[model samples]
Target: MHPRSSLTVLAAAAALLTTATTATAATEPVSRAQVAAHFDLDAEQQPENITVDRDGSAYLTFSFARQIARVSPSGRTHVLATLPAPEKANTPNLGKAFVGGIARADDGTLYVTYATGTAELTGVWAVRPGGRPRRIAALPADGLPNGLALDRRTGRIYVTDSVHGVVYRVDARGGRATVWAEGEALRPSTFAGANGLKLHDGAVWVTNLDKGTILRIPVPARGTAKRIQVHATGMPSIDDFAFTGRGDTLLAARDDNEVDLVRPDGTHTAVLTAADGLQTPTSVAVHGHTVYVPSAAYLTNKDPNLLVAHLDR
Candidate 1:
């Protein structure tokens, strides 16, 4: 399928992987062979975001299928939760599920985003193993919620509205939501707005895709945190990212087929690319020293694939 994605691309990418002199020595440049690809998931799955559990299982958002699936350590994938499909075709969300962002709570519960054209199904849904999805919070009609992150310690879920440039905080129990941050800078200039999010090290880290900047907000114990500050800039089309769990290093998946290693100081270098067998890596998740990335390949590549690269050895 998809003609196996051209080996010539991988060969050219290997040549430029290891040239960063100031990068971490322990983090080796990932080559094509070093990255193992798995899960020829159905094109209808349209896998978008990924979150790795402690046991190394990767739970991904299946956008088109209107569901979520889990990839085991051995790479077999099965549906975790399925939502209501669109009733009519040619609607804004394309009559498919907008199951976009995914994040996990400390208690093994999942909070997922569904920005569907259908009003009833468009909200934050909750799921547990062997359970059906229950809408926890209903996103307003004007909201186009996308990326998500959970603050386990505070038992709150943070969601990003790509259309409104607003960050919402919802209680994990009742799903009561309120706009935590609304800023002109957070709004999208192009089609894509705030696209990726993660809660780490006492702060909420977010990437504005259309605006090409990374913003950081102090973690709030309650309503909203003020003084939103821009942490990094000039990163265009960056998607979901993962903390390397190693000294503030970040693996950010750029929609253009590369996973960037970003430092706290806002400097980033490419460690993997399309040549490294990445078609359109949309999200990154780290398990131990290795990083797992999903090639969303929505329209171009027929089979959605997952790639793993050992970032720190």
Candidate 2:
């Protein structure tokens, strides 16, 4: 993540509406989104990414706070784990220890990516239900690891390095990481690249924050990755996205205080915006007909909160 003025992003998004014209969602009479839980900005409760459990509880990585917390469906929050902060924080890109993406595995294990700019702590971490958080795989301290996803079938974890423009693969139990993929599509243009990642339909899907595009890479059973394909384009400042139950349709969280509904055709519509209490939404999660958007307030420095919405069937 880079520091981009929300005004500038709003202008760019307004212009994009001409080409990536509004879908039916924009014409809907009522906004489905509402703030479900609010956090203390003074405490640095900036939620950077989110993962929902089957019980409707959400696990969040409070980026600047270096803590992982769980928000119950009833809006109660409890700190699950607090990552050890480096003595002298100097993370690349952000200049501090920041926990970004998180994924919840079956049997109640949570995995998250941490970028601390220190060789001892920069890597993927696993948090068991009642155990402490431990680093599983160590990544390059110079690179900013942003997004993470788990392939449940193979128990393989995939991570995206925003600064180095590389994708790494590691086992569920953790070990040496191997460079899975890297190319121009994943490289940073201004600040960060390959910011968000997900596994769906036998492929790895990622979002490039600088390039403003969504890419898809096929993961074959033979362990060789095919060509990278551009699945969607013209999305600037896109952080993380979650697919709706409707096939390829997704809701993308932009750092500009807005969320867009992107269809399989590569077109999108503004479904939620600043008026809906968004303050730099970082990631999105969908469980059943409910959508979760966590705003980090990175730029706004106001209310960092989790906004819930009823997903129209």
Best by lDDT: 2
lDDT of 2: 0.85
Collision pairs in model 1 = 9-275, 10-275
CA-lDDT, candidates in order: 0.72, 0.85
User: Across residues 1-313, which tens digit of lDDT does each residue of candidate 1 receive?
Assistant: 1333334323322322322112222224443223333445554666789887665567898777777888765556788888776575222424445788898776778879887665677788899767888989988755677899887777788898887788888888855688888786678886767778888888878888888778888876656778678877777788888888776678788877667878889888888776656767788887654467877786456546766655543
For model 1, the run of ten residues with the poorest summed lDDT: 16-25
Looking at candidate 1, what is the lDDT of residue 249?
73
Give candidate 1 misplaced runs (Cα > 4 Å). Answer: 1-43, 89-95
lDDT of 2 by residue, 1-313 (tens): 1234444433322322222212222224224556767888888889999998755678999999999999876677798999998998789988989998899898899999999999999999999999999999999999999899998889999999999998899998999998898999999999999889988887899999998898889987776576799999998999999988787888899998778888888888778888888899999998766678899999898989888776775
Cα-based TM-score, every candidate:
0.85, 0.90
- Compared with the true structure, the alpha-carbon lDDT of candidate 1 equals 0.72
